[model samples]
Target: MPNSSPPVTTEAAPSEQPVIRWTEAGEERSALWRSERGAPPPKRVVLADDTTTADTAYRQACEGTALLWRGDFHNARQLLQALARRADNVPARKRKKAAQVVPVADAFHQHRLAQSQRARMLGMLLIPFNADYSIPLRRAPDVKTACTEAWGPADAAAGASVASLRELLGITSAHEWRRKGVEIAALGEPPHNRIHPHYGVFSPVRGEYIQLVATAHLPKPPPGQTSLMAFDVGTGTGVLSAVLARRGVRQIVATDQDPRALACARENLAQLGVADQVQVVQADLFPEGQASLVVCNPPWLPARPSSPIERAVYDEGGRMLQGFLKGLTAHLAPKGEGWLILSNLAEHLGLRSRAELLEAFERNGLRVISRIDAKPQHPKASDASDPLADARSREVTSLWRLAAIQ
Candidate 1:
């Protein structure tokens, strides 16, 4: 057996860091705790193995007891799947009886609550990682690369650490996604068209918005200007920047507040051969200088995010939307058009209103020049069983072309 002790670090004293404790082989054992979701160390933990019954595991997990799997790694995954089935298996009769037509906002809230609870319960199935990011269990495949990509290099001095199997699986999935890359039609055919998203950066899974950006007309430069320059606000994976580069934009400044996104954008842009044309910078919303064209696609939902990745999806109190709008006038060069890519699903969910959006634009001294709309083709839109299907089916992603008030 290889040494699984965590690598020591000067960042925090051992006594100050979180640890997970369990009893095994008639002795007490513990390891450094890790959770990307920020879940605290489990208050109670017990060793589980191949013989652990799914029923018992589910019941214990529901009771807030963590299961430290000592069984075959494959069996642990199977147990996780079993836990999910049990969690989702509301009897048909019970579901029918409990079903009530809720207000769209209520339905969205309820759905979010259920999702949070399910994640918490499933996260109770913990996996131990050796100092090198390998699982010390039978049938455990090497996860060193995936773990390193997501969590950075293993701390040899910190000894071993423990994290939920759910998150480990997510890390592996993200690794595959980063390796394979997502194809963007806007950038043209495969091979050169893919945007490899770094772990934690939002992938360009929704192509409709990208298509709108790809097809929308670029703002013309002023008479004195010889070339076109564009600002891509909150650039994730640099897909929009790449699209603009493909469309022959002379120069593009891509800005993001997230370090991961900045790195991801730069890598993807380089991969797509747009590195020379795009400049990736870290900024709150906009870079220092103004551009003839400023483009932003903020998180459509105006709600608090539960995790790091959710930051790309939910914008609490519409902070990003408001920030962009309020700063638009200062950042727009002469006759520059600000491209605001938005989704009206927020409106449909009653989280925001069309009139409110218009009001913000007007207050910011910006007026909508024109709007290009595209219906989502994602499978969730057509799924009748989705809790928020009504709102999703009616969703329309739009590229709102805005100009400063003369």
Candidate 2:
């Protein structure tokens, strides 16, 4: 249901790149298969062009046949839209009927299965790109910059390759986000407020959580300590670190294990003019020493992530959450507070329970001193048509204030 199969690609040898072979122009042609999400190369591929009907393409795609587009790029996009309409065209009454029969957890699983299947089918539509990341089809956009940002400098020696048009579009979208940036009111107004998210790093679009950190009470430094030191664990874009710095924390150490996240956090902190006040480090969870305040906003769901980006959303076994809680007490200074920013979405979805979370804090020698809650302001929270809309509507994000047990 979760697309659990490992990626399978045809590799000539361990040292060679995986290749996709297909028949075109009465000749056997092959090229490198590229998938940022580690999707396997299609087992069967057929060339499709302007003359290809959306219905035919949809049928072929459903049967696991990849369509290598040779026609106008815009047509391919339109065909993809058509495929989506057909894929999601199930009657509303039927959907409601299905939802009525299944439990919420079962519904969530079924929803994931549907999503996985849809992605596979849609990904069957491929676009060819030159080694420099240029699409050869007429009306294709200039995507060299976006591709370079996502895949790193293109290898001119690797020749042409094929990838999902959807993925390319996503890269393009992420590039725009990186360029335009997302504004954080918690950081202040206008020109100084934006946080430019890197291609793979998670964007802090949910401002409620950021606001929670921005307004939370800073713990008093122990007697005789003149300055406040804080640790921002798993800092994705350094947004929380910036907030801590702005709140007058003397020095803040922000740590993340991901290279992209580390780089992203450093760049954002500099851009926000707080680089001098924050130190971005690489670590699994906590850094070397204890801090007066320790903060973490781990992934909300305890489910398997399909890709690196999804890691910011799914925690698989609540690993990050537990890791932070278990290590919080050891990383907090005397009388210091550990602020855990988390959502109740997992509980609403039945993936976890509130009692389990509280028990985790107690088991880790931590006691909840207080909590600050914020209602989600994201659009999905109000989107009644979403499969999990019922759960989302009641979702509340909280910043749990914890201190080490005496």
Please report, in order, the local distance difference test score of every candidate based on alpha carbons. 0.90, 0.89
Best-performing candidate as measured by lDDT: 1
The per-residue C-alpha lDDT of model 2 at residue 286 equals 98
Encode model 1's per-residue lDDT on 277-322: one tens digit a residue. Answer: 9999999999988899999999999988888899999999999999
Reference-based lDDT, residue 272, model 2? 89
* RMSD for each of the candidates: 3.9, 4.1
Report the error of model 2 at residue 323, Å: 0.7
By summed lDDT, which 10 consecutive residues of candidate 1 come out lowest?
A: 1-10
lDDT of 2 by residue, 1-406 (tens): 1111122334432445678877765566778787877786898788888888888889989989888888899999999999999899888987777758677788888888889889999999999999999999999999999999888899988889889898888999999999999999988888898899988899999999999999988899878998999999999988999888878887999999999899889999999889999999999999999999999999999998888899999999999999999999888999999999999999999999999999998999999999999999999999999999999999999999999999
